[model samples]
Target: MTLPDFRRRKAGNQRISFVTCYDCAFARLVAQTDLDCILVGDSVAMVVHGHPSTLAADLPMMLFHTESVARGAGGKFIVGDMPFLEHRKGQSEAVSAAQALLRAGAQAIKLEGAAGNLEIIQSLVEGGVPVMGHVGLTPQFIHAFGGFKVQGREDAAAERILADAKALEASGVFSIVLEGIPATLGKRITDALSIPTIGIGAGPDCDGQVLVLHDLLGFTEKPPKFARAFGEVASASVTALRAYDEAVKTNTFPTEKESYA
Candidate 1:
């Protein structure tokens, strides 16, 4: 289904759930769930490659993950993220990166910015590519903001956050992801925007919520504070691996009865 249709459905008070994935295995698992969307977020820098921050993720890396997730998503909407320098170069570069994502099987592309990116969003929309807007605690700007801190906590910054939400909506984005903001401010933005607001620690008042898949599965050694661990897959995986190791060391695996004649 198109993103506009998803937005319309969400406008009726439907709560959309989004999860980030970086590979086919996770995508396959997500496709079986009731998730409304799967974001191929650049968080792969942290979750997959052990990078210090998302800024280290490049276009090729994003494209690689986007392709894998798209191939395994089945029917879930795949939202590919444009990495740090891709969009800042100019409108043409943004369009090219977005188009490449669509070609790689993404149903839409998400970028982080407001005023500086309206033209790129408009151009992508006009060209028939669905776009999701991301604001608040944009990791790509960690240097400018001086680390991964909560945004919209102060009065002036909150106002700018509201303005950025409105600007993204006006630019024709189907939805906006509000990350790391106060609950009251998130509610206000959700109420003000025509498009749906998907929050990740932004607050409960948002139209929907999203979390990294690894975080949700308890695979990350240090997940964000706002993330609630839904399952302990990491511990379970470790236990299973340890069992296999013991079996191999004890010659308990590949018993004679298990061998083919």
Candidate 2:
């Protein structure tokens, strides 16, 4: 979907579909699907490289994945994550990082949280970088949060998140990802924002919903409670491989017609 489609979809009351994929192979598959966008998320550190968390994702790592996804994503709108502190360093530093991400093929950049980064976000938007804001259970603040827990649960915290969402919109983000917040709060923010709200564990009231490709495909052994696995890819893959292994062991593969005549 084009950038304008985000708002148009929201206006039309249509729900957007977004999924995160880290590499070209899956990106090619995602491109062929009806999914609206692809995010080269920092979750790559955990999903692809076996890191314990997104904290391991760095500029170079995100760049590499963004480049790979862009190469095979066709016309899919790609949003790359600004790994960890990439945006907190300073305005110039954030712009430089965003420029690199854009050059590496992200049409937009998704940064976690709105507090303490409004100025930088405004500068990026004014400079013409499409920024996607993320708040409420930002994974980058996992330590501060003590774990991957729901955010904006209390009245005070909910008000803060609502305020942050407003601030982010004022800073010129095209859309915002409302994550790990209560469904009511998600609807509240969605109603409050002029731009689209993409939900991840934030509930169905959002303008759109996003899921990790692995989680949706059942590759994740233990996905978040909000994630729904629509396909049994991991188990099917293992079953297929086992069949191949048995065929090879029994010399039942590459026989007769399968071999060069």
Largest lDDT belongs to which candidate? 2
Candidate 2 global TM-score: 0.97
Model 1 lDDT per residue over 77-163, tens place: 889998987987987888889888988889999989797889888888999988899999899889989999999999999999999
Task: Provide C-alpha RMSD values for all models, in order.
Answer: 1.2, 1.0
Cα lDDT for residue 63, model 2? 99
lDDT, candidate 2, equals 0.95
Clashes of 2: 0
Worst 10 residues of 2 by lDDT: 86-95
Judge candidate 1 against the unseen true structure and give its global Cα lDDT, from 0 to 1: 0.89
